[model samples]
Target: MVDSVVLVGCGNMGFAMLKGWLDAGMLQPGQVHVVEPTDALRERAATLGVNAVAGAAQLAAGLQPRVILVAVKPQVMGDVLPAYRRFAEHATFVSVAAGITVNFFEKHLGDKTAIIRTIPNTPAAIGKGMIVTFRNPHVGDSDAAFVDRLLKTSGAVASVDDESLIDAVTAVSGSGPAYVFHFIEGLTEAGVAAGLTRDIAGLLAMQTVYGAGALAAASADTPTTLREQVTSPNGTTAAALKVLMGGDRLKNLLTEAVHAAHQRAIELGKV
Candidate 1:
C-alpha cells in the first residue's frame, strides 16, 4: 500500500484515478489527499473519505507525501506548479497532462526532482485506458515501479525510454479513442443509410465495434489473419473489404489522420 499520496486536481481524470486506487485496495482513503480549488469538486473527493482542500496552502503543515500526481490542464500548469514546489524534492511528481514534458516539470519544480510524464486517454475513467509513461533521469527504478502500480489500477501501463516517442503515443493511443468513436458514428450512419432505423443502427454499430475489439484482444492471431478468416471470396464481407482495402484507402486516410494528430502533438509540446 502507498504510504501517502497527494492528487492535485479532482477533475474527471484525477477523480477517476483516485477512485481506482481506493476501489482496487491499492490505497486506503485516509492515505490520499486531494487538492482541488472548486467547491463541488473538492466536496466530491471528500466523499471518498480522503482529506480534500481548496489549495496547497490548506495542506497539512509539515506533510510529506510519497507521490503528488498532477492531472490539471496544461494551460494552467505553470500557475499551479509553483504552489507545490516545496514538496518537489521529496515526492515523485507524476503528470497526466498531454504535451507537458518532463523538462517543463523540471523547469517548474527543479532539475533534480523525480518526474514521470504520462499520457492517458479518457477511457481511463472506466478502467480500460492505455497509459504511456516517460521518466526523467532523476527518477529511479523503484519510483517508476511505484507510479506504474498506481496507474495500473485504472488500466494497462506501458513505458518508453525515449521521451520523444510520447508524441507518437499521444497521436496513436491517446487520440485513438476519438477516432474509433468517429468510426462508430460513420458505421451507424452507414447502417441508417442501409434501411435500418437510427436506434437499431446505433446499437448494431456500437456492439459491432465493442465485440470486434474484444475478439481482437482475446485472439492469438493477427488482425489481418482474423480479418481474412471472416472474409469469403466475392462474399458480402469481401465486398465491404474491397471498398475499405482497395488501394489502401482506409489505411491511407488513417495514416494521414494520425500524422495530423502527431504533428499537432509536436506543436503543442513546443507551446
Candidate 2:
C-alpha cells in the first residue's frame, strides 16, 4: 500500500485541486485515488491517469492515504463522512465542504483525527483560487504545511488559528467570486447601454477586471491610491466615483451583503 492522496467527490472544486496537484508536479498520477460516484466525473478523473473508484470499498485493504480531501457538499456530508472514519488512524482529514466545521468532522471521525477545514473559492478551477484554512490542534505544522502545498496548486494559501473566522472567510473569498462576477456583469451592461456592441462590451468589462486585478497584485500602491491616480480633477472617472462613493452607498451595501453571507454560513454550520 503506497502513500496516496484520496480525493472525495470529483466535482468542479475537487477536480480543480486534483488537476492542480498533477499539473504542478506536486503529486504523481499514481499517488492519487479519486472516489467519485458519478460515472461522468469518474471518467474525467481517469483522464488524469489516477485511480478512480466509485467508492472507498474498491480500495485495497491496509492501504492508507496520507491525505483524504473531502469535497462533498455540506448537506450530503453526514452520509458521506462516516464511511471515511476508518482512515482517521493514518490520514489527515482535509475538508473543503462549505459550512462543515472541524468539530463536525471530529464528531464523525475521532476527536484525535487531524482535521483541517478550508474554504476554497471557484477560482480554483483556473489556478487562481484563494484558500483560507483553520486546523484543529491535532494537526502538526508539517501536516499543515503539506496541506498548504497541496492547495497552492490552485493559488494562494493562508492559515487561521481561529475556526470561527472561517465564516468570514467563506463570505469573503468562498462566495467572493460571485460578487466580482456581478460587478463585471453590471459593467458590461453599462457598456452596452453606452452604445457599445455586445461583444465589445463584454470584452471591455472582462479585460478591465482582469487587468485591474493583475495590477493590484503586482503593484505596491494601495488600491485607494490607485483609484485616486485614475480619478483626475472633474474627469469622467471622478464623476463615476462621486456617485459610487459619495454617500458610501456601495461600501455599505457590500458590507451588508458580506455580513448576510457570513451569518448564513454560521447558520449552516449549526446543521
Candidate 3:
C-alpha cells in the first residue's frame, strides 16, 4: 500500500480524483498531501483532512511521498515538475494532465524514475470515467499495477503499451464527453423544435441518451447489431438514421473531429 501521495494541483479534475480515492478507501486523508496554490482550493482540500500546502517547499523536511500525482496544466508542467524531482528518486510519478507525455516527466525526473501518463474523462467526478494509461519503460509491473489500482478508484482503467496511442486515446475518450454533451444539446433543441416544451425536451433528450449508453454498455451484442435491432421497416428510427447514416455523414464528421483533437493533443505535448 502507498503510505503517502502528493497531489500537485487541486482543480476540478484533480479534486474529483482525490475525493474518489478517499471515498473508495483507496487512500486515507492522513496519507495524502496536496499542494494547491490557490487559497480556495487549498482550503477545500484541507476540509477533506489532507495536508494542503501552498507549495512543495512547504512539505515537511525529509519527506518522501510514495506517489506524486501531477495534476497541473500541461503549459505549467515544466515550471512545476522540477520541484518534485527529489521525490522521483524513490516514488512513482503519475501525471493526469492532458496532453502531457511521459517523455516530459522522464526529462524532468530522469531515466530511472517510474512514470505513468493517464488521461481521465470528465465523468470521473461521478465515478464512471474511462481512463487510458501508458507507462514509461522504467516502471515495473508492480508499480504499474499500483498506479492502475489508484486510478480505478475513480472509474474503469485500461493500459496501452504504445505511447503513441495515447494521442488517439485523448482524441476518442478524452474529448468524448464534449461530443456527448453536444449531442444532448442538439437533441434537446430538436425536441423543442418538434413542439415539446423546453423542460420536457431536455428530460427526454437526457434520459434517452443515458438509457442508450447504458444499454450499449450492458448489451452482449455489438453496437451495430444493437442499432439494427432498434430499427424496423420504414420506422421512425430508420427515418432519423437516414439523415445520420446517409453517406456516413455522422461517421465522417466524428472522424474529422477526432483527428483534429488528436493533432491538438500532439501540439500540446510539444509545448
Which number leads on TM-score? 1
What is the TM-score of candidate 2? 0.96
lDDT string for model 1 (97-193, tens) is: 9989999999999999999999999889999899999998888898789889999999999999999999999999999999999999999999999
TM-scores vs. true structure, each candidate:
0.97, 0.96, 0.94
- Highest lDDT scorer: 1
Model 1 Cα shift for residue 9 (angstroms) = 0.5
CA displacement after TM-score superposition, residue 27 of candidate 2 (Å): 0.3
| lDDT string, candidate 2, 127-167, tens digits | 99999999999888887898899999999989888999999
lDDT of 2: 0.92
lDDT of each: 0.94, 0.92, 0.90
Ranking by TM-score: 1, 2, 3
Cα deviation of 105, candidate 3, in Å: 1.4
- lDDT: which is higher, 1 or 3? 1
**Global local distance difference test of model 3:** 0.90
> Where does candidate 2 stray beyond 4 Å?
1-3
* Candidate 1 stretches greater than 4 Å from native: none
| Model 3 clash tally, residue pairs | 0
